[model samples]
Structure formats: C-alpha cells, structure tokens
Target: MKGHRGSILDIAVVADGQNVISSGQDGTARLWDSAQGACIAVVDDSYSPINAIAVAEVGNAVNLGSPKETPSNREVGTEGKLVVLAREDKSLEGVSLHSRQSVFDFEGSDAFNCCTFISSVGVLAGGLDGNIIHVDITNPKSAVETVSWSETPVLSLVPFRDTYVASYGNGTCYIPLKGSEQVLQLTGPNRQPVFQVAAWKKLVYTCCRDGFIRKYEIPDLG
Candidate 1:
C-alpha cells in the first residue's frame, strides 16, 4: 500500500482474492496481501509508466519459463497464472506469476494503454495510436494480428462472451466479432473518451468522460 512512489494506475485481483497486483506511474508492479495491507513483493519493474495490467489463470497453455529457484511461501494461487503489463514505453510484457519470470516482452506501435486476456494463450493490447495488437503466448516472437481504425487513442479493452470490446478516446466503442471481419458499434457518446468497459450477461456498459454510464444490449453473441 505504501511502497509505490507515484500514482497507482491499475490493480488486478489475484485468483485467491487475498492478494492483489498493482501497477503505477512509478514503473513497477507490486503484490500486496489484501487482508493485511502489506506489500509482499515488487513483482515487476520497468523503465516507463505501467498504464494497465491483467491477470489470468493460464492452465498449461504455454511455457512460462522455469524460475531459477522455488517460489516463496508467501506466493499463493499463482501456480499457473500469467500477468500482462501495458506500459507507456510502448512495451507489452508478460510475466509468470508463480515463478516471477518474464515470459515475453513485445513492442507496439505507440504507448500501450490497456491489455486483456481473451483465452488461455491469447492476449490483446491496445495502444495510444488506436492500434490493437494480438499476441499468442505460445509464439510471442510475432503478433497474431494487428488492427487500427479511427486513429484515436484506445482507452480500454475487455473480453466479453465470445468477442472483445474496445473503447477509444473519441468516445467510440466497438465489439470486434470473433472469427469474422464484422464489428458492431455501440452508438451514443460523441467525442468524450470512453475510459472503461464491462460486460454482464448480454449488457455491455461503458464509462465515458462525458459523465454518463451507457449501456448496450446484445441478445445473441453467436
């Protein structure tokens, strides 16, 4: 809680819910014991500000690279987890939670603002130049796909049922359909930046800088 030197950017709850990972403008990520509010470890350090981070339980999807030694007794519910960090230095990095090792480090077009896990081995990162980069954990040497539109800064990205939702600085929200070139638009906000997006059942919600929460309904995702 008191370890970071600058403003905290994003935090992700660990699988056990007792520990959390937080990234900050201080260019580091820290793992904290939620119940005790104690800083357990400095999980990651970078040269630029980390804008966002995501954590997911990756079960045998890809090799996380072996750690030099055994894990500490303090690390819990981190056996097969992966953490992805989006940094202002145009780097999208993956770290193994259990071993605390770097899995992969990728550079994007511009500063990455957000990232999310779509599957066991699939990862998506959105950058300030409106480019979305997709990487697979198995072979991170190259990107699976990269898409750009509108040229506005991508503010947020989230996984829905089948596809993923992305919000932009131009106040636009789009759902990039899975396995198809089709993209559905959520109309409403004009030009205010859409900061966050969430999905519940068939409803998709967007938090906009215009000071309103907008909801869109999608009955069928198939």
Candidate 2:
C-alpha cells in the first residue's frame, strides 16, 4: 500500500480490482499494484504536490448499485481520466489515466484544496476562497463556478449517491446533484472544522480538524 515517497494526500481504489492510485504532496501520482505492493506507473507533475485523486469507469458501464449476479462483459476502454489538485498554484489538472498525459488545466480563484469528479457533472474543485469550480472535462475551455459563503476555505469535496458533500472550516454541506438548489448543512460542536468527508455504502464519514473521525448514517431520502 505504500507507494509515494512523501506524504500521501489522497488514495483512490479503482472499481475494477485490487489496484490503487495515490497522490501526494510530492507532486506525483503513482499507480500501485495492490496485490504485489509495487509501483507500476508514476505520473510526474513537476513540483505541484497533488492533493486529491479520483478514479471512475469510463463509457457506458454497469451502474454502481447493480448486484454482482448481473452478467457483464463490458470491456474497459482506456478512456478514464484523473483529476488532481496542485498545491502550488491552487490549480486543477486533468490527466488521462489511459494515456498518462496531461490533458488540460483549470485555474481557480484561490489555491485549490481538493477535487473530485462527478460522474454526471464533470470535475468539481474546492478552493480556499469558499468557491467550487466545475470543469467539464469533455470541454475544458468552458468551466463554471458556484459561489459559496466566503468565510471558510473548503478542504474536501466528496460526491455520494446524488449529492455532493463538501467539508470546510466548521461544518459539512451536502448539495444536490440536480434539480432545485438546496443544501443540507451539518454543523459540529464549537464550530470545529472538518478536513475530509467520505461516503461508502449508506454511511458518511467526516475527519475533523479536532482529531475525530465521525460517522453519520445517510437517511433514506427516497
């Protein structure tokens, strides 16, 4: 599991198998063969310490919720992409995992803290200025920004189910993936800042700056 030479900022497990990709403050992304614990590929990004990494299946694939019994002969094409947040300029870089090449770069208002790719809406980047930049990877030239309360810097962005959960200085907010504009805000005691938020199964976990990892059950909204 140890791949990067420096601090590992983020690690993402591919949906296909036992392979994991890690990004670090070391400015490089390394692909690790989890079964063998060996580094397979190193994607160099100069000295721009990478803060986040996400991997998703490309093209028309089986829905994530499908049962294992479903027969699938889907061929994985080399069309997946990786989104990285560079600490130096607070910028976001899109690199194709299949090609291992830098595809495009998007500038944000301030230093970007983290980023994640939304399967339906493109790449979402969180910054120090409390703004979220949405970049359409298919058309990198046209990116959009969604303004937010400017008091706190966003540290992490995690998309779960159909909502995007964002963690900042003192709380976490869940934004709907579509439809009417609405936000579900969860505040912590004494306004403790949350550093990271992750969603798995029907639970959401938040790592707080107060050195506590809290888990919240996601209520059925169906």
Candidate 3:
C-alpha cells in the first residue's frame, strides 16, 4: 500500500492471494505481502505510466520466456504465471512472473486502459479509442481480433463464460460472443462511466462513476 511513489492505478492478487501485485503511475510494478503489507519486490519498470495490470496462473498455457539469471529467493508465487501491463504509451506487454522480463510487447491504436486474460492463451486489451484488441500469446505480433462497440474509451473488462464483458467511459457495457459478431449490452448507468466489472456464476457486476455498484442477473447464453 505504501511502496508506490506515485498513484497506484491497478492491482491483482497472486500466489492464491498471499501476495498482491500493483501498477503505479511512477512506472513500476511491485509485489507485496498480503498479510504483512510489506513490499516484496519491484517486479517491473516501464518508461510510461502503467495504467493497469492483471495476473494469471498460466502453467504451460503460453511461453513466458526464460529468466536470464537465477530468480531471487524472495520471489514467491512468481513462477508459472504471467502479468499483462496496460500502459499509457499505446503499448500492451506481457511479462513472465518468474523472470519479470517482458515476453511480448505489442502496439496499440491508443493508450491501453485495461487488460485481462480471457483464456490460457487469449488476452484482451482495451484501448482509449474503445478498441478491444485480442491477442494470442503464441502469436502476439498481430491482433487476433479488434472490436469497437463505441468510440468511448474502454474503462474495464471482465471475462464471463464463453464471452467477456467490457465497460466504457460512455457508461456502456457489452458482452461480445466468441466466433460471432453479435454483442449484448448491459444497461442502467445513465451516462456515468462504468469503472469496473466482475463476473461470478453467470452474474455480472459493474462499478460506476455515479457512486453505485450495479449487479446484473444474466440469462442462459446457450
């Protein structure tokens, strides 16, 4: 909580919640001891402000490059995982948790606002331009897909079953189905930006700028 020199932008839990990883406006990503609230390690550094981050346990799901040196003994729950950084400089990068080295860096149309891993090898990075660019970790040079439901900057993303939910600055949220062009919208926020979203048991929840959290009971998608 106190190690970041600048404002903390986003955070993710790692090591099954024993530790927390945070991204800061100071351009650093740090790991922390959850119970002790102590800074564990400065995991990464970026030239641009890291706007968001997400961690995933991706054992053999994708190739997170080997570390050049022996990993520090203090690094706990860092192996066999990956961290995705959404930066303010129109770049989205993937880093190996164990190595803390960038595995892939891809260019985005605009500054990335948020990111999340939808599957073992599939990643979704939403940009300021409202473009949600999908990347395949195995082949990150090119975008697997990019969709823009609206021109407003994307605010958040949450992976749902077989599809993912995206929230936007314009107070719009959508669920885009895989292998199809159709999308479902989550309505209610009346022009207030939907800041974040989370999914559980087919239910979706949104945190809005209007100082209220909304929950949606989704119907059967099959």
Candidate 4:
C-alpha cells in the first residue's frame, strides 16, 4: 500500500479477492488488504526493481512440496495461492501466499519483463533476453521449457485457449502452435510496443503504445 518507495509496476488480486499483491520499482513485492486499504506485509524484496506480478491458486493435483517450517499467522490465509514476481534482477520467484515461503526461485538468461500462470502450478515468464521460460511449479526439479521468436524482449503473455499469445517490445504479437515450430503473427498495428493483453470468449484484445486498442477474433480452440 503506502510502503513502496517507488512506482508500482504491476498488481494482482488474490483469488480470495480480499487481498492484492504489488510489484514495484522500489524492488519489493507487497501484500495488502484490499477492503481496509492497508499494507498487510512485504512479501519479498530484490535489490533491483520488479516488473510484473501474478497470482494463481494451485489445485490439489500439483505437488509443491512441504513447507520448510510452520507458517506464521500472517501467512495462514495463503495456503493454496502463489504470488509470482518478474524482477529486473533476472529472476522469477514464486512465494506462497499463506506461508510467505519460497515456492521456487529461478534465474533466467536476462531480466524478466512479465509473467503469467498458464495453469495453477504452471508459470510462464518472459525475459529481456528474448526467452520465454515455462516452469512446472508442482515439480521443484522440473526442467524449464524455453521458447523464443526473436531477439526482442517479451512484454506480455495472455492465455488463449490451449495455446498462449505473446507480445514483444519489437511491436509483434504471435501465437505459437503445438506440434509444430511455427509461430503465427497477428497482422496490423505498426511497430508500436504492445504492453498489455486480455481475452474474452473467442476474441483477444491488445493495447499498444500507438494509442490504439487492437482486437482479434480467435477461431474455435477445438
């Protein structure tokens, strides 16, 4: 809430809807009570700035391993949720919402610019080094899957059906198909960085720096 010393870059509301987590340029990730508009606690801190934050509720199917020790009173409510932060320190860290413990801390090839959860225990983080790393949080020793389309930094990732759509700093948005190495680039919108993306039903929307909101219709996922 009022504790961040710099600009807040991203914020995600917990599944319970009562709390919100924020990543800031001040190099800290904080948890806040939404209803009371108060800072509950500082979730994590990196010496460098954090660019994005995402929250996901891990279902029973995933094995996130046992906590190192008992959770404190402040961490009791976050048992099933994970707060993920994309940091300028070239790392992607997942923290347990309730226990305030580290689920996994991974270093990437470069600073992570954005991140999203493809599933409860599955995460995707895009880096400035032009790599998108996918992690299976259920398995601590799981091998990370890396995907790359260009040398440009990936700025956003939006889930679309079985696949996901990604936007880059080079002003390109693409969808990578399964069973093939090919990527389909979305047409229109000149070379302007697309910063945010969202989806509804069978349509996808993107907001670009060119001052325009672009919409695209996605075919049946089936």
For each candidate, the alpha-carbon lDDT, in order, equals 0.89, 0.67, 0.89, 0.81
Backbone atom clashes (below 3 Å) for every candidate = 0, 2, 0, 3
What TM-score would every model get versus the actual structure? Answer: 0.95, 0.79, 0.94, 0.89
Question: What TM-score does model 2 achieve against the real structure?
Answer: 0.79
- Report RMSD for candidate 3: 1.5
Give per-residue CA lDDT, model 1, range 49-165, as digits (tens): 999999998878867767677765666787789999999999999998877789899988899999999998899999999999999988889999999866999999999997899
Tens digit of per-residue lDDT, candidate 3, span 93-194: 998887777888999999999999998888999999999999988789999999899999999988899889999999999997667788889899998999
Model 2 clashes, total count: 2
Error of 3 at 12 (Å): 0.4
Model 4 steric clash pairs: 75-98, 78-97, 78-98
Question: How far off is residue 128 in model 4, in Å?
Answer: 0.6
Model 4: residue 64 alpha-carbon error in angstroms: 6.3
**lDDT preference between candidates 1 and 2, better one:** 1
Candidate 1 global lDDT: 0.89
> Candidate 1: where are CA atoms >4 Å away?
66-72
Instruction: Give the lDDT of residue 176 in candidate 4.
Output: 83
RMSD (Å) of each candidate, 1 decimal: 1.4, 6.9, 1.5, 2.6
